[model samples]
Target: MSTDTALQVHSLKQSVDALSEKVDRNHSDLLAAVGKKKKNKDEGDENEERGNWGSKIDFFLSCLGYAVGLGNVWRFPYLCYRNGGGAFFIPYTIMLGLVGIPIFFLELSLGQFTSSGPATCWKFAQLFRGIGLGMVIVSSLVAVYYNMIIGWAFYYLFASFTSKLPWSECGDWSSAYCLDRLPLMENCTMRNWTATVNGTCLNGNGTLMALYNETLSKETMGIKRKLPSEEYLNNVVLGSGFSDGIGDLGPVRWQLVLCLLLAWIFVAATLSKGVKSSGKVVYVTATFPYIVLIILLIRGVLLDGYQKGIEFYITPNLDRLYDARVWKDAAVQIFFSLSASWGGLIALSSYNKFHNDAFRDALLVSLGNCLTSLFAGFVIFSYLGFLSTDLNMPIEDVAEKGPTLTFVVYPFAVTKMPISPLWAILFFIMLVTLGVDSEFVLVETVTTSIMDMFPQTRKYKTFTVVTCCAVFFLLGLTLTTNGGLYMLDLMDTYAGGWNVLVISVCECIAISLVYGVRRFLNDIECMIGRKVCGFIPWVIIKYWWAACWVFITPFAVTCVMVFSWYDYTRLDGYPLWADALGWLMTFVVILGIFIPAIIYLCITPGTCGQKLRILTNPLVEWGPALVKHRRLVARYVPNYVVDPWGKEDQNGIAPSDIAVEMQKQDAPGYTPSPEYYAQKM
Candidate 1:
């Protein structure tokens, strides 16, 4: 061949070689993708095979931890005191038995059986997962404000060291000192020239003059006069707001900021490792509250007026029970207090192992929570009785609202006790721990759901959750200021109080009626590898949950609405914006349930061909007709099963088949017979 021909042939050979190399690389890339997919599948299968498996003790502890929070210690007792002293318990117990316990078991069972979070568990039931999502959202909202309260506890813990008696000190200097305004004290104390003062102190010539030779002398003389009458000074302190007593330089704001930071740091650290860390934390977090309760109870009862407090707590008048409204209030209290039927428990329970005995666990947790609430009431009332006696006030006067109980009344009690600083420190520390743990878990539940829904954004989910928490903290800060009390009341009553109860009842109804209660019960029995007792079915399905949802939810909502409307119309300073926000939140929660269910039902028919469709996908549109379709599909399909990509696999083997297999395995007469095999063949 010629030289030119040889050169062309050489170039051709090189081109072929490069093409071959490219093909090989592409082939390797495809194999790698396949291998990665398989590896993920293997890991997931191993995780699943490890099965709905958790240490029973750990599971129990976690459930207990989630159920019992600062509410049990700080909120419940005061609620009891305000509602009707000991009379509250009659309705409280009735509510727990009828509503709380049933809803608790329902959420626990749904979670463990589905082996999914709140969002997924509802989807598993082929119901509106929005309701579950609403619970998650509500929890997240709550966690934000809740953490802020924990931050306050943290602030108190830090302030305990610097102040002589952080809770008891009285003076204008006291307020300034609590707020860390030492440098600004002189400026703040300067008389306002703009004020119209008409007093002899203004001076004989009507020219303003210093009350004493210098500011320091005036301060010293004031202190001297107050020192001899410390009791009188304390009375004055009690009458005035802390801001009026303490100098602006007090460490209160710094403490609050420090608390917020510390809370964030602790929550971030605890959750950084995910469930493993949270689970371990729960062991202490759940139990420590009880320990504190025991200590407080022992000390509280030993006080001089302990019997009076106890009488106030337990003096149930049958007349209170005669009013249906009182019973309704009790029911609402129980629902809020136990947090049953709330998506929070449902989401948390979803993390439980498939074979976990959630039925029994739910009962224990619910009962334990209620018992703690009752115990806490006794501890609180006993202390209040002591305070009443010491202050020469009525028990009714000493017994105040929730915030007053925690921030004022309880502090007053501590100050009167021996070695109060130590007890105060311990009490606040316990509150911080209890509150933070619950708050962190709530944020994590929402974060986990977000991560599950958008795996591609997993890297950013934690940051997103932290940011969400931070925003909530800021909002809570606004609520922490002197005038924030009214706003807090509005939020608590409309957003946190009545709204939560209503949403919970709706959730239970959605699960019961839409999902079919019988199916859920069966799912629970199979998942736990045992038969649920007959009582659960009869009580949960037939009467308890149904009655509460029908009666209690409506009544509470009406009361709240009436109160809100009256406030909006009559109260001069009522915040219309807050009212609007409250209604908006309520609407979001109410409509949230139906939205996802509708979407899932709508696309389910076409979803079979487009198997990538998922219920959690934000792109999905929800409508009533779609929900109907989902229900129809779920009747024949096992809606709970998920494909490798975490999408619900509706074509998987029917749940009924699995139920049958489980029954056979568990049946007494399930032994294989040679004659049976011959007949089958």
Candidate 2:
């Protein structure tokens, strides 16, 4: 308890601190020296380690192509009509604000800032690495059945080139129930056909006279006939005429096998060189569908009964807004349609130049996706209207989703058009284009994540792509069997389901709580600039940051997940084993989330709290990908705890001028000069 003893202890502590500082300084200097030497040695041989889009336009088009996919056409229109017509947009746009644009921007910013794919991008918070794995799992499963859909589109496209569309008339593939044209039974005597000795109409339906006349005293719903188009799809396309269920899968259909092979071939061809090839390919694949959609819309509007279809599509039923299911549908549609959390957005945006303005790209692609979905509603419903009048069915009856809408409803509608074959060709072509881009982009997402994790694999890009495509094609052959339609439906129902919702929720938690929202914003600011250009852009960027902090996106996605589970329906007619299998698939994909976290925690050397803190913190390497931008980050945001430059303040105090410096950047369209960073550094 002596003053001399206290003074001695303080002096010894100061000496220890000085020694630690000296050691740290020497370690940093040694690293800098080694880095400089390596740089000098590799200056001539170093190529750009990662690829970029040929231009900003290539990036935009690739995003556009992937965002505006087949779902916009087949799924959106039906959802709109089903969820109270135009009234659906209220929830749709709301969901877009809460979930779509925010997540879209988040993924793009994550990839662009890190210059990495989904898997390796998690270097920001290693504990959440499973998010990237889960994303890849969803993308991989989706790619398999999604390519099958593309194959079906290809099958229909080739069939459309015939002098007469195959589905336009009953053929050998037609079952006993196929009706080429509905017999007019208005006069109680069916037109164009007579009751035969077998007590059936010549057109393959039970005699209307027998049903209508005999059932005069009873309530009769008529013969319940099937369309020739339906028969063609079931018998010829799916070859499922006798398929009882998934357990009844018959021999693989060689024709569809050829079509699927062709689909994979096209994907491999486009992705052979990664973004370089896909970027150029998007110029065609991305824009072609719009032309067809516009043409079809125009043609559709001019058709009879178009008003009823358009009315059914846009006629807002404000009451449906009160339904939770409608809101759930809107949220699910927006999430899937924009391809959020699917890893495609992350993969596509990861190819940008370091300083590329992902902010503008995010807005452009998000708004474009929404408008495309709305515009597609007009195109699809207009045809549904015309088909409604032609078949004497209600607009609701003709409207459908999934393969039913794409193959049966649309094909039958086209058959009723002038230049039926041409319309058929254009329609199928649009489906192919819409589907192909999404299919390959998902494949790219999977490939990008792999190559990023193992940089050495990047050199064998073509070989990697071929192997990926070949593997997917082989797996997809299961869906080419007689009962594949049932299997595809099962996969579609379970593959993504609640799994992606879990990832989205995890992403929000990781970014906001684990990684720290303010720090993430600073990192983003390092790439896109602290001051946004215009008033609206400024407001948007601010709103996005607020949304991230407020947990709006995760909360919204969580609610949707709850509603989805509440509304979950067993895959009809599939046995209990099939349902169990679907759940197993979901569990396996979800395991992608927890397994990595556990493995990461186990390997981290520390007590529980220390290990968690370390796992949550970004690696020193996490920041802008380029050297200059990283230097700017170190100079401007030097208070970040894990600065790679070793310039972090020991006292943990950020510069008081940080706010004033940002204010100085507030000038309209202000751009930093190289000298600004140079002087600061």
Candidate 3:
């Protein structure tokens, strides 16, 4: 070799050595600064009093309250009746086991591990931070419309305190078409109405028809009728006539606006202190509904035709399984019922003490949610059977969904029993309690996420909660207008429907695929260990959860999205603009996932490959929230995997190789293991 070339090589080696020494010094200083900051932050955390569940029971009830919502009372019974009766449970159970519990366990563990809300928890994979943003938006949209339903319940509960139910005889709200009872038209033949037909019997047009002799005749027997209860709901509760459609949402009903305000006030008061306050509130809001449900069930079973209703609910039609829509409905119901992908579970679990056995909580909450749906089915169908007998109508005619089932049909059914007003009060109170639990929890999710993103706001939790609830209440006022129900329906269909499925697909992929299922399992092991309760296996950390998170969950949720798109039918009677608005809302959420990712890639300072690697890597702060628990975490995953300056990233050291060294502790120099650094922390 040339002498000049050898000198240049020696100079380069010296320069590299000097740079390495400088980097090591800077890293040491950085470590010290981080440690001091952590110490100060820990002291401040104690002074400020971090929000936590008051007890283990507080966490359980809060989760249960959020999971088992109004859907259990209204939606599930109808779906069970519509989709092969008892046969629907087959798809429901399959979806629950494969898709429901796995995702539930994932969210609970993720939140508990990070001690952060949905938005901030994505530090593990920053590229997917948009998922958290999308979750917040979806929850916000739902909160607006959800409060309106609660307002309607409040309106009913207020009306029930009177001696007579307003819907019983339909006072001022009744129209000429309102029929409290069927007419004595035994001799008349029901037929389609025509201008040429003139008779003294009611016509199919819901109006009186006159004959040439002005006497009642069989020719007019085709007249249509509407129930007084239906008129009360349409005119009194909804005032649907004020607005022609979504395009023209008429004047707000002051009464409904007041009721909505009351509901929001209750929610804000409950969440005044964040989860600490909400934790205590859930004890009543969560358990009261069960008491009312059991009471109603006892009352319903004593009714005459309840046996028929139960039979209708449980009578399995195996043929219905052949329909794809049945499976889709089951998947949707299970997803929404457990409140997966909504961020509430994550937010609720985030307040739990670290290592609180979230695995057991997940199992208990999911099981409670499913069981409540089934139990509520018995109560709902039993009442429907009684309604069928009292009205002398078929059980098919008695069943309804959404507002009609709870506010209209159920209220009318209450009027049929002895001491009708007492029963009416109990029913609406149950609705209010059930709805309040869900409403406050949704608000809590939003507030928790906000505080997570801005730690400074944690000290002013009450103000934060009130501000959020007030914003949501103002937004919900539009739904209290005459055409609000139409708007509510549109939002419900578009905001929370397919977008949620898409988000679920993204979440499953992000945590299991991009983050590496094996690494995630190791983290789970670090937190909860192999067995819970000394005997029950944490099966979710086993092969079953691995398969579901990696393959089954993503695939199942994708199929649901595809089927929903295939079955997409435009809402009848809605304007094209309204449909476009719905789609626009949906796209906004979908873009929430993509736009931030593009921005992240553009701003990151590195080669495309380096940027991708950094984006996929877990943050240094991604381990257990408490430093104490990270020792076990370090035993499993190398500290360098999270530390940017660690040789794992710079020297192309494989995680497996580092794992071996962590166990052997035979490294040449100072090794940055958790035990070594945690002491500094």
Candidate 4:
């Protein structure tokens, strides 16, 4: 051969070798990828196979923290007050025992059994995971707006430092030194008082004369009775201040924005590390609100006339209890206050490790939440009583609505006391912290569900979650505008109010009926390694609980609708079209939970069965068999093999195949061991 031909041949050979090597690497990488996928599948199966276990004490605390939030503090007391004062507890306790506790246990058990978040847990019960998805979405929306409120609280907390008195600022423009009137007063003073180009005294009065002045005498401010007039009360105070004023648009706006940023930062810091970090963080976050509650209660009760507030709270008007509305309100309050059926609990419980005892945790957390709410009521009512006495008005007159109660009445109360600013700052700070912790959990639930459903995005889950939260915060800016309070009322009543109660009832029925109470009881037993001995589960599942849930849930919902319709029709000046839209929105929000559940039930009947099998079959098959054969089986079979015999196949057969064959032979998997099957057949 020619030398050139030989060199060309060598070059061709080298090229072929390089190409072949590249193919080999690519094949290896592909195999590795496939292996990783299989490994993930196997791990997922293992996760599914594991029984629901209760968490460590710390983890349980975190889960409880997520459940106990701003609702317990800000909303529940008002609910109790409105629904027959102390008389409300009668229905409240009934609802708690029949609905709240049962639902709490049910949701926790479902989550633990499935080892899935709300989105997927519904799938386990053969309910539309979309119901779970809708819940997750609604919760996300609520969390967004909820955080905006937290931002407001934080802003107020910050503002308390700068203001002479945070809560008691009057909207009086005539006060020369007050921050609110400074701009208008400045222009008026400058225009009227400045010497003109005409060289005459611009005003016969000097610059000081142009400035508006208030007659600051004891009569002007001293001991004004029966609370401030509605015209003087801002939405923040129930006085008729400008809705979308400089407070919302100017410095207050900046403060609110800063609060949003801080909220984001705190949530990110708490949840970025996932459940381990979140669990630890909640120990402080969940409990701090209570500390504030304790402090407020101590201070409040100690104040003179505090007993009047307590009386206002606890004095049962027996007449009110006779009203169906009162009972209805109490039921609604219990549902809302406990945060049941909100999907937050489902999502939080999903993070619990297998074997985490959620049963005890659920009971503890619910009780703790109730105690806090009760104590908070005492704290708030005591202060209100003081205000009533100070103003020499009826408690009803001095008492205000929700936001007003916090911002106006509470502040007014503090102002009456010495060192008002200090107390105001503390109170708002407590509010901020309480709201922040709850809001964080709400957002985190959304984040977790999203991450769980889209595992491929795990690498960037945190970024995606944070971005979603940022967008939500930005959207919430609408609420910070003048019409924000109206919007808040609309969302709360329509979205959070009626929808929450209805969703919870459906959730309980879905679990109890579709999944079956026995399965759930089994799941509880497995988690705690003890039987749940009683007629309680039977009573809840079969008759009383479901009946109560069915009756009360719809009634509560109708009340919301009726109230909304009446308000819009009578008060809001909304058009017929607006009413239609409002009803449509209400339907959509409530249906958000139900439609998904119906679809899920229709599509996946075996979902719950499969999960129960995973959780219970392992123990049912081997636990008793192992104990029976402990002495006899050891000589022939190793403990590891015997312990998980039903879980593992002795031969190379698949476990599913073995399960199938065992079923065919009408024997449990463990009963037909290799030795016994060989002998019998």
Candidate 5:
């Protein structure tokens, strides 16, 4: 090489090295802090720990991705329409402040305070280890069918690649009454309606109808035929009627089965390398969907009937505030949208450093979830408003919830837009990514639980992730059968619904009442480097937060749960037996709270009162996973302590502390034993 070329190369190398040195100098303390508790992979290593996020942004986005998922985009919009549009915000916001954020902050405290998964965080209340188990169980149950929802999005995504959207027209999968009248209805007036005779209806003139129903005014318009989209969903996609009930799942739909397999593979591939990879994967999974949401919002607002849709979505009817059911729905939406009572919250926080400011992090995530849901409502309702105008139907008739709103209403609306295929692909891809982000954490929650229980599995993460994917995939197969939607609806209603409320109620009671809210707050202050008592006037974060946990949350959640059960009705299609089975399934998860208590009580050597005392006390084996973590905790909040077991740590204890016993020896970075180890503590 010539001397000039060599000199240029040498100059570039020197410049790069100089820049690197500057960065190292600027971030020296940050680098030192991060490297202190780096992941350890060694034989019989007690200091073995999971890797944390590469940076704070990773954790924030990961939490955002997990909390604001499919429900935020689809379910929240429909619930707003059904509950009271603008009026729904009152109860929703009220619940958010009173019940939602408190529980959110509580879980963050419990997990970060100990650096443990949900199952292992229950040392504070040994009798309620079942609460942790219940969280994992509910998450596992929801994860099965949740993936099936993604599979449906995949099917539509592939179907959208056609020259024309397949659900655009009616054929063999349509009902006899189904009719396409977009052009024909263009010239028709409000007086023009579907006519009824003795035989059938062809373009609103029906012969098979028993009578003329249009004599009375209906909020509905152009009801002479089923929309091609609705027919495709009911007839081609779900094929719901063949099965007797949840009991008869019917034959599997091969297309959906394949899609389900693909869904599991998608999730497994995302989680195969654990958080080391997933922390980076979320960069796309979490943030890119906002781009699609923005595009849809802009396109929707510019449509022909945008004003009407926004009106139906945001206009308030104050009368709804009087209904108890509206309040119940508000609570349910908060629970569903924020992903509270799910094990994912604890599992996600368990990866944080000892002194991470989780208080600020929790506020960011919870409020971000609410804001996303609110904005998504605008995007959805705008499209529905357009559909209403185009079809000459009322806004109410165009809005729906759950799968129908997502897979049916939205997909059909996309087909009507310009460059329909492009919009369809982007919309479905957003749906898949949003759902997959949450599923990633859910799959990890299960893996984290099992790994925490059996530390050796950490070395075989790939095998464990694949095995989890396979097991959940096989379990999800029932939901891909001809009657899959019906089974999904049933599982959601039973295995998924009230069980969440039960878990939330049980957790609040255990944490606030049994574990002691003040003590919990102390632990949190230790981590966040600030007291809960803040300078927000009548609203100190710690004082109000503690009040909610101790009084407001438990009371309010109990009332809602009671109100939910007061006049519960069974699903329409299923027989009486199915309702019984649904309740039975719900009870099974709640039963987890008792199972551990029963076994522990039976095994412990103590009197009845002694057992009660021991059951309520903190376990002796609980403390920081490493001396370094403990020191960090002490350094930030010097007055705070981690003496849960009350064992001496250059200090003394008085009470008969609760004794926690687990079969597995592994914790965050230390193994527990019957006798406390001073050096480890």
Candidate 6:
């Protein structure tokens, strides 16, 4: 009885197993047929559905333009001097290695492999989609204020056409206390006149008041004449727009409004056709600035004070590197200079041809950005050095920072040069060029996010581009008003500064912690090859990318972020509410990121535990853009799981070599034969 029962039970189990296998095979077969049909259909739609950069060079130039922007030409040099001069490079390069290239590579590889924008790419973890949203928001805010600065530059360029640079001497609008020739060194730093009067309120004691008056009377050349350049910026061009406190949003400066209008028009025209127009535009906009920079550099070094200014620029105060603020500045500078967490990098890289070598491009572009900054430092400080000598001032006192460094001080110094107006035109033009080029990428990032989130938007791409421009124009109008400078300060401080740090931190956590760095590395390995030898490995040269993602980047960003919060410096000069408004701009972006997470939890199918798993899971749809990409990925990342989309061998496995073995490998300078274009292209 027992033998018969055992035999019957065993036979029943075998029958069940066979039926189950047949069902599974049928399901796989069904999926295969469906995939084949979709593949055929996608081929027909691929032309319009997928757009790649016209050539690798175009992409490289576009990246160069975006990363080597005003931040490099204007912000970086100032930050270098203001922080610790040559010592700034220690923290800067360290942060660049820790956070810059890793994040840059992360953005580029994410876009190229997925062929998507930041908003849609977060499908890897639905909960992390807010990152893309936050990025877009940050990009949008930056686009607004950033263009405003360009408007200012444009104004200066137009004003430079005067027979003699108006800023060369005091005009009728100059203050009674104005000085035609600004003092050298410490003298110029001392408020020319009014600060001494105002100092009385702070120093009611007769002793302090007498000391201030004695210093001013002796050092101020016995007159309170405004520096002609300062007067020009404060009165002639700006038209006393900053006259009142930031309490009132005053009338729009018509000249600035026109300049802003012109800037927007240029951006709209450039980006209307999307990457095609921007790519071609970058060829000029990106390279022209370097030409001007070089011209100025040559002009600058040949001048009198070049050595002194450059000395101040590169002279290391090693002690300053130990300060937390210096470290924070380095991190923030790297973030802004490289355009990280703004979505622009992701958006720009999204247009690349599938299987493009994004890894090499990332390293090259990131290093190029740093080199460009150092070059810019020389170009800038050389002039400041000359200016310092001209004014009999020390480099520290006369080497202005930020907008003052760019617009007021630089223009003032140029006035002392031969053919001042010509140099002025070139300098302002360079500023405008850098400004407009960077603006292109920022707006493109916003545009790409919208197009991806709602694919239907592509049908009205022209309309959408116009709408974004119009919207940004309207928002930027506030910056065109008298209080616009304050508005720009507020937005720039909030949007691109600390908030970007938070966004960077979140990205590292999302990919490395939530989406899985291993998964991302597999994706990267597919588009670009495995880590190779040479000066190839950055820093330690092995698993450097992975180390950045998991350890270095997050830890570095966190240290800077925590230090920032510890001191929490707000953009000074405004009221408490102005600072509050800036904080609001930051939080609203951060809060928006959580919205997607909430939506994911509600709509995701599964038990609470299952939903949590999905929150932490990578979608199967997330992977290389096509089979070529998958094959490349398979070569290096062993045992990687990918959705082959039914491309399988007889053994029922996606053979590592089957997909790409026959394809020519990418060599030192070797390029893939263009399936749809010239091989080199």
Q: Write the per-residue lDDT of candidate 1 for residues 185-209, one digit (tens) a residue.
A: 2232255422122211232454533
Query: All models: lDDT?
Result: 0.59, 0.82, 0.81, 0.60, 0.77, 0.78
lDDT of 4 by residue, 1-681 (tens): 999999999997876676556556545654555456546644443343221222365556665666666676567777777777888888777767766676777677667655667776654343444567667766766776777677767766665685366335445422332323222132333554653322222245442222232222213433122222222234342112445422233223444566677887788777675665666766677677777778888888888899988887897766777777666666666666666767777777765655556667777777777777787888888898888787555787566656767766786788777777788788887887677666766786777777767876557756866677777777776666545655565556555655565566566555555555554454455555442222234334434434543455444545653664454432164445545654665577667766754554455436776654443222322211222232232343334234444443445333442222233443323342434433433
Give candidate 3 misplaced runs (Cα > 4 Å).
1-49, 181-184, 189-224, 539-541, 640-681
Summarize candidate 5's per-residue lDDT along 195-266 as a digit string, tens digits.
433222234553233213321212243335457887787767766646666667788888899889999998
Candidates sorted by lDDT, best first: 2, 3, 6, 5, 4, 1
Question: Cα-based RMSD of the predictions, in order?
Answer: 14.9, 12.8, 12.4, 15.3, 13.0, 12.9
TM for every model, in the order presented, reads: 0.68, 0.83, 0.84, 0.68, 0.82, 0.81
Per-residue accuracy of model 6 over 1-681 as CA lDDT, tens digit each: 699999999987876676556556545654565566456544432324556677788889989888888888778988988898999999999888888999998899888877888888876777788889989998888889899889989999988998789888777777644554333222322433233442221223322211233235546535332457877776666654355656676788899999999999999999898887788989889899989999999999899979999999999999997798998888888888999888888898888876677877888999998999999999999988998798665577676667778887889888888899999999999999888888999898988889987988988887889899999999888877767666776787777666778888888898887777776776665555454323353324436777888889888898888888898765667899988888888988888778888988999898999998987766666666565455566666565454446665555444332222223332112224324122222
lDDT of 5 at 657: 16
For candidate 2, report its TM-score: 0.83
Which run of 10 residues does model 3 get worst, by summed lDDT?
A: 654-663
- Cα displacement (angstroms), candidate 6, residue 131, comes to 0.3
Off by over 4 Å in 4: 1-55, 125-127, 166-240, 243-252, 531-581, 594-681
lDDT of 6: 0.78
lDDT of 4: 0.60
Clashing pairs in 2: 87-316
Question: Model 1: runs farther than 4 Å from truth?
Answer: 1-54, 124-127, 173-254, 457-467, 474-477, 480-482, 532-573, 594-681
